[model samples]
Target: MSATGAAPRRFRHGLVVGKFYPPHAGHHALVEAAAARCAAVTVVVAPSRRESIPLDLRLAWLREVHAGTPWVRFVGRHDDHPVDYADPAVWDLHCAVFADALGGESVDAVFSSEAYGGELARRFGAVAVDVDPQRRAVPVSGTAVRADPAAHWRWLSAPVRAWLVRRVVVVGAESTGTTTMARALAERFRTAWVPEYGRELTARKLATLRRSRPDATVFDVTWDRDDFVEVVREQQAAEDAAARVSGPLLCCDTDARATALWEERYLGSSSAEVRAAARRPALYLLTDHEGVPFADDGLRDGEHLRAWMTGRFRVELAASGVPVVELRGTHEERLATAAAAVEDLLAAGWAFTEPLLPAH
Candidate 1:
């Protein structure tokens, strides 16, 4: 409704088209405007096949960001046609792709922020609606985002932020301060952190055993291949959920790779499925168990095997080829070391591959 008490003008159907190299706030604004002005809006995400970001991923991110708007539909199509604004033949090729994506649906309006919006509307036989043509509403561009994602991070949606967040997993032997380190790092960075799901599962298993045998101790808490698989799946789900809402850096107490090693500690061997679930994180902070006195926390039973497990983690991490930063000395020292490594990581910045460029 307007201030004059008149209903807002709307069209039956509107079309929005973009490469969406990676959908930033500007792209979202265009779609939102179309959605508000049209009864139904179709957003055509047309990226070239040679583009770095996948078409499906762009579509998924857009859908996630605009989930509240049910009237907006997103479609992905690979438009590898050469981009030449002055070439009519090239424009025709691109329009053909966009038209095919529409599936014979008539568009009453074309909403865009590009100079080519009028031509696009003419091709679709729809009215041209320019939206934020100067980029004032959302002062960001895909090119700027691609060049340095961290600089333009504020303009990105949660899903896109999750995709760009640098995940750092803290893993080590029992009672080695992995949780403590992970928590401290999250606090230092003012970001979200994922707790070890396996620990919660352990507590649950112990409680379940107590129902049958009240005297069952941590020693009696048995595990199998399926248990490890469940831990891996839940751990990854938690990490992903945290990443979406986390700052540029996400800290984790442990990860699926650590779970595989734990599986070997209990079940005597890690399964192919368990090992396959391991994902390479941006960095690994291994808390050394050297001077840390073992305190039996009811759930921990690996006091004597701490040295062996630490060695195993070191070997596995080294073999995995992901960069590892071992934390030793007092808790404060370890935190400093981890923080320094993280600072270096953030300093490196994100590097997205260049998308398909328009012909000169």
Candidate 2:
């Protein structure tokens, strides 16, 4: 039987491709158009192409950029020929390879602005539709963002631009290597990272008393309420800084949720307000496995403290409502797990970006 004769009654799939460099409002319109025109849209974000954002950052940006559109998803690989697109022979090869991979998997139509899409569609036995809402070539082109990341952002839909503001935050008690793990994830993902806010306040101890605590001087400051609030403020400031300048994704070491956890540990209860302060992150990277012998840098007293801190930190952050990914094993293993999780989120058609800091 012919392939077309066996096809589903309703259009089963749609294929869309682009560099999607921090995909903006215009990109959103294109995907929405394709989704509306078909059953499902496969959004191939080709980070491998030149003039594209880094692969990990591209995946993160795509997730937050198209959060509400459930029909569209992301892929790392693609069939793209940026310079040779004008030559049909080369273009056809690009289409053949990409189309065979994506189109072979139940694709019934292809939606694109590229002129060669129609030829590829016929080869793949799918309908072809070209969509270009804004006809002006140069201004609407994605090349603008590659040249100036700051300027063309305003042209994007408010939500998509906001998703581009996201940063992944990892929270834990002192001695958990939160900063080290954060740096690893950032380096692995090729994005910015927020250092631990508590260390900036603490005199080395993961949870220590403050200078102004009238009850006592140093020793175990965990019970000090004033110190807890101070740490929370410190975390809040860090999260704010991360989101403001964050390009694609920000990996934060610790958040206010960790502060609330410390409060619960020493004070024996969590703060509703402090917990509320942790709603900024799109997702949390929680650590489950321990690594190497921890140093007693005055800050990291022992493994018991680290374990206690991890437990308290986990409960509080989970309660705060940010989605969390528990990382474990070696640095390579942990970051690899996180990288995979981030990519999966982008593939499922959800862009996870919260605007600025969530209002307390």
By lDDT, the best candidate is 1
* Reference-based TM-score of each model: 0.92, 0.49
Task: Assess the local accuracy of residue 107 in candidate 1 as a C-alpha lDDT between 0 and 100.
Answer: 93
**Model 2 bad stretches (over 4 Å):** 1-138, 141-163, 204-223, 289-292, 317-321, 347-360
lDDT of each: 0.91, 0.63
Residue by residue across 197-305, what tens digits does model 1's lDDT show? 9999999999999999999988999999999999999999999998888888999999988998999999899999989998989999999999999989899999999
Give stretches of model 1 more than 4 Å off. 1-8, 211-215
lDDT assessment of candidate 1: 0.91
Put down candidate 2 lDDT per residue, 1-360, tens digits, no spaces.
Answer: 122334334457888876665576667676777777677788776533444346566666667667777777777665344435446676566666565546458677776766656765776677876666344542555655545444564565444444455567776655555688878767876666888666666554433343345354334534467677777787667666665555456788776766777677667887777766656667788876367456666544345677777776576666766778888788777778888877654444332222121123
When summed lDDT is taken over every stretch of 10 residues in candidate 2, the lowest stretch is 350-359
Worst 10 residues of 1 by lDDT: 1-10
Number of clashing residue pairs in every model?
0, 10
